[model samples]
Target: MTKPLTDQVVLVTGGGRGLGAAIATAFAREGARVAINYLKNKGKAEALAKDLGPNALAIKCDVRATDNVASMVREVTETLGAPTTLVHNALADYSFNGDGRDDLKTLTPDHLTSQFETAAIGGLNTIKAVRPGMEEAGFGRIITIGSNLVQNPVVPYHDYTAAKSALLALTRTAAVELGPLGITVNMVSGGLLRTTDASAGTPEAVFDMIADNTPLRRVTTPAEAADSVLFFASPWGRAVTGQNLIVDGGLVFG
Candidate 1:
């Protein structure tokens, strides 16, 4: 049997660690050439590439910078071939410690902007950088990592949730525009993934509460969420576009 992504090239931003790392590994497992993009964690990214063997490469680029993003994509194309799949998983530095989070009143515009720059604008940059290649190839898979909080907002994470919400809108709009180009743009929203770096600061009680509320009685895993991403890139999702797949163990419907 042929691999689902054989001969495919994938670029995963912020793939140095955590959820991004898991996504990159999943793609590598599926026989895709993987480019792991990192901002500051060169050591971790290189290690992951090495672990993934010859099919993976470690690249350093700040996703929020358009020039850097363009350069990164160009390098990935030259090294691994023009990416047929792009996963925008880069995130601004944030800890999921609700008690220590900035309340609504204390939330500044800069804080929101920072999150938007990394989450929304960073995705925009990657999409733009890869659009030409995808359009020329007439096949593309664009997956943005989102949060289930946009649907439930249970934690009131003002900046992060707001930025992801905006990303959802962009995903839909891009889907409509890119669909005709034979490219599918979608999002995979996972809730409180177990043990990701972003969620490491979450209290144990909060995790317990989330697990109790979910139908599966457990939080989603990054590897599990990564599977959904693979779906969009696979032939199985050929006709699916502009949709969000919530992988939070039934915590949020639709």
Candidate 2:
């Protein structure tokens, strides 16, 4: 069996654990050289790279900083090859507890900016870093993790939702600009994953509520969502770009 990603070098930011880790594993399974980028949690990142075997490496970078992102890409290229695929999964520290979340009155610009720094701005940094290599090769795939909350906003996670929305807009516009160069930009939006560090704080009741209401009768798993990200990178997705693929098990319909 042939895998389209076998010849590719992939950089997955914030790929030390949870959904990011799952995405790295997916790429590794396809025989792609995987660079697991992490800002902290060195042990988790290294452990995952080791588990992915010889072709994968763990790297560190704060995607919000262009210089750091550039350096990170250099290291990845030197070690793994110029990254032809990038998944910007790095997220700022945040908890998904609705009760503790900032409402309009309590929400400050700082709160939103913090999320934007990692989600929106970080997405920009990675894309720019990889643009030259992708343009040179005339082939690239850029996938950014997004949130279904942008459309549903059931719980009103203002900061998080706003940042993801911005990323989605970027994905579409970048797709247009990069299309001529053969690089496709897309977003994969997932609802509260069954369990991740970010969503672990959610009460079990909320999970049950989501499951009971979702058409699939279950919450989306990190691995399941990771597979959707895979679709946007594979050859089958070469013609698809600037589209947001929702992986929330039909919980929120468009």
Each candidate: RMSD: 1.7, 1.6
The 0-to-1 C-alpha lDDT of every candidate, in the order given, reads: 0.93, 0.93
Clashing pairs in 2: none
Q: Give the local distance difference test score of model 2.
A: 0.93
lDDT by residue (tens digit), candidate 2, 137-214: 889999999999998999999999999999999999999999999899999999999799999999999999999999
Candidate 1, residue 26: CA error in Å? 0.5
Write one digit per residue (lDDT tens) for candidate 1, span 67-162. 999999999999999999999999999999999999978999999999999999999999999999999988899999999999998889999999
User: What TM-score fits each model?
Assistant: 0.98, 0.98
